[model samples]
Target: MRRTDPEGHGPVRFGPPLPADGLPVLPELSAVLAAAAPLGGSEPVGGGPALLEAACAYWARRGLSAGPERVVAAPGAPSLLLALTAALGGDVLVPRPCAAWWAPYARLLGRPVFHVGTPAECGGVPDPYALLETVRRVRDEGGDPRLLVLSVADDPTATVAPPEAVHEAVEAAVGEGLHVVSDETWRDTVHAPHDTVLIGPAEMLPERVTVVTDLAGALLPPGWPAAVARFPEGEIADDLHARVLDVLTALGARVAAPVAAAAGYALTEPEPVTTRVAATVRLHARVAAAAHAAVVPSGALARPPRAGRHLYVDLGPLRTALGAHGVGDAQDLEEFLTARLGLPAPGGHRFGDDLGALRVRLSTGSLLAGTDTELEECLSSPSPVELPYTQRALITVKSVFDDLRDDAQRWEPPR
Candidate 1:
């Protein structure tokens, strides 16, 4: 339990392993890195003009207008979030099941993180009524609730919060005087971008929200850690932006020179980077759907993944079968499923869900690895589900859960 945090080891906590994508770097991106690798120095404390401008352009394309001065870049989202948490001091309220990496940074700042229950429609934003109730309850309990971190396109659950839901949450947080930090890292990875109405919190509360996006979420490889945040324009926001830059400077969290160049290139939406991300998201979406299909018939419950490379499921219905195998809580379920499926099945507790809940998040990347042909087929094929490797992966998920269903039936007592 005392082991280093899986997301940010600096601030130690029990975090689930971040999903690993084994795909090779894109050729165009590789060319960019190869070209930039020879010219070396750290970027400026808050990012150089080129990178900042590139980020501004990226945000503008997403319909949130901002200048280069309002954006800040860090080596990774965790470091950036750590700086943000330090700059804005107060207790944090996160949704019940959020990205596993969000809380440690708050804890690193010695801020208590409270989990508000989320609406059934999505995993990231808190239920509006629950949000209001929790804020008042925390104040009554002597907590200074000031920051609320949320995601529009979430990890684990892979649900994209609807625009109306986002508006309600923003209204509640702003009404409560809490600055919202919207983690829009998955915005570009929506399985159906045109159909899904992705709204950033900054769009809802212009002067009271900060937008953060990790390049690794879609635009760049995970090894090249780069993330950018956009602070809304206003006098108070300007001062807060300065504080964040100072914190970044103090922590020496500047982006590496080559990575900054690559991130800049990726953010500009060149055809190569755009195509690769679209293809990858498509592959993951199909695989996630297959996994969801396999589990549901066996009594496991999951929302259809709308974005990202993972799906969250509740296996509480199969708890009777799992209990027979000494898998009682979330951790036990995690260990059992990871070993059985030969993949990382991070328990729900890793994302702030209750310890007693039998739930886990399964990464599509875990099942997407194989021979070059198989991997290529997965990336480019119209029906990846027809491929042998893809079918085998789904079969494995179905077989395990189907067996559990049988076990549950066997253990049931006569009525």
Candidate 2:
């Protein structure tokens, strides 16, 4: 998992495929643990009252109003998603090129999954028109597409859906009677708070939408693995909440007591946590922008990252040049980059993109490689990306694209 850039060429990651350097360690975490009561001998079927109350306050800050009774917690968002998929008991509609875990989780629960293309602006919510068509096509073929999962602030593509688009997509899904799971894990990670617009489906269609938040992404440390869901007030919501708890109970799943204590404190968004989150967002945006600048003019097609820690790269433009080197598809592209540039990125095929698309998800997180003290300095620095450590990572990324572009320009097809 550790691939050295060789001669300080770039950064390397060895953990869960997320930005590692900027992982914030909350100062309050230890105090929260110290104050927490000993774990009871029995596990709670769902999130305890304290955690649920904190979750409600977290959502309220973003304009969604809910009480603790409507909130349910799980070990993490993925676990909650699994329980929800099983409880809902029908086909699932997901965006083409979504978070890597969604499709696989649905399959594990034995639910059929259909993909709808995303709007040009983002990768989480499906394209409104395509969503309706896909739903109809599935139902016509006797596949009951009953759930639509999306992220208002998306992953892989790193673009936030416009408020208008969120409204349209939710309207379409609700009109078709699909229960929507809106993943807002990255909502608090918006790079530019003022420039980005995020409207959760729960805000628009509370009756039919369940908002899932992963605290690890924006608040807590990634290793903690805590998440909560806000359900709309209704009999169906009540029943689904109970079913999810039952499933979690069967699986012997519960967020660790200490982690749950941290979650409660983090969800309240204390000033220190907010400051750290904002700093992390700014760091990612700068590094990703630097990487984007290097890739776009070099014949790769990529959307300028607007939020989160990634950029979606399409290498179709270099197909001829790549094909000359036996790199004509997504898998080939992934291997070629890792072998040639010492960079490792997940191919689009893993996210339900076409195998031949030559697309890859590039994470800027690795740009944050260094000791904790160095990373903290980078976060606090007004020009973090300009620091030697961070600058070298960016330069290495730019150099890879520069070489690729040169090769493409000089390449001549074989007879």
Candidate 3:
């Protein structure tokens, strides 16, 4: 019953799909793009207030003190983060196994990024005790620790910080006077509404935090670039916002007039698109649940996912059995699954997990398609019997474990 790895013919998608909702609405300046089509004619300057205002309103509605002036629109979150790192110009701290972009973002700017281990329950926010120690260790090494960037509802692990955990992390940062940048790119895709608390980081520490979000993750039709960072209140925030605008101007990072119109519309009216995104969340929960059920001991290595749209399966317990299958580590397991089960999950190495440890992220979103019709159908179906792709994925993963158990028995010495 040895599981044979399935060969991958092309790219396998297992992440949130950008909603295919129609073009966003922009009533006032619909003529901006057509008129400025010639190498930037008028283009409506000042970073587009309607766009920023919409972003601010969205955040404020979420209980964040995101004033319109504090809203800084950029092409996307990564660019704005790079600019902020440059302007702040000090030591930055991030949790280990973060999104692949964080390391490169720091490397490109020649900024040092210190990685601290997160709690076993989550992956984005660092363990509070470790946070304190890391801060001391960094400053002791002669680097001024000024900012802490955390991704609530993290990308790789797909876990969200509990409200109390969020408060705890911020309290530690406050003690050290650290400015916090919370990336909420995946906030809209939480698997369970009540399981995740959507309090912006600014709510936890207003004067010390900035929340960065973009239409890239949850909203449908993300071709256009438009993102907003809700900065802290006060003169410092005013200065930072101005600096962001200056950098955007220098880099020509304005969200095109058409995209801004669309993004503004989406930000203001997100119910329809959000309903579309929820389908992915439901799919993740179902697939994860099936995988958990398939485990021989049911919870031996698989823990229930707390939030987000992915599952982090630990293989430490099955290491010896997996080794005999020629899967020695996370990479081997990833390859085995992709080749045999037709799953293309990223290995632990991608997220800074221990190389030798057997842990990999399983994104259940592979069931998604580019079309709204398919997405709509997936959303409406509840029972695994309804969606064939999602059901097949669950079965394939379950087959892996069934093979693992059978293989263990075969490898055992005769009694």
Residue 412's lDDT within candidate 2 is 51
> Given candidate 2, what's the lDDT at residue 150?
93
The residue-by-residue lDDT of candidate 3 on 176-266, one tens digit each, is 8888888887787676887557565777778888888767666534555667788888888788777767766676776666666656766
TM-score of 1: 0.95
Top lDDT hit: 1
TM, every model: 0.95, 0.92, 0.82
Q: Give the winner by TM-score: 2 or 3.
A: 2
Model 3 lowest lDDT segment of ten = 1-10
Candidate 3 collision pairs? 5-339, 5-340, 6-339, 6-340, 14-366, 19-220, 19-221, 97-351
lDDT of every model, 2 decimals: 0.87, 0.80, 0.67
- Write down the TM-score for model 2: 0.92
Question: Candidate 1 on 70-168: residue-level lDDT in tens?
Answer: 999999899888988999998888898899989878877778888888888998999989999988988987888999999999977899999899899
Give lDDT tens digits, candidate 2, residues 1-415: 1111112112222112543435547677767865764753322767888888888888888798999888888888888999999999989888987887777678877778887888887778888999899888887777888899999788778888898889999999999999999988888878888977667898888999998888867877777778999988899999998898888998877888888888888898888778878888888888889889978988999988888888889988888778878987777777787776565676777677777788888888766768878888888888988888888877887888877788888885665
Report how far off residue 40 is in candidate 2 (Å): 8.8
lDDT (Cα) of model 2: 0.80
lDDT of 3: 0.67
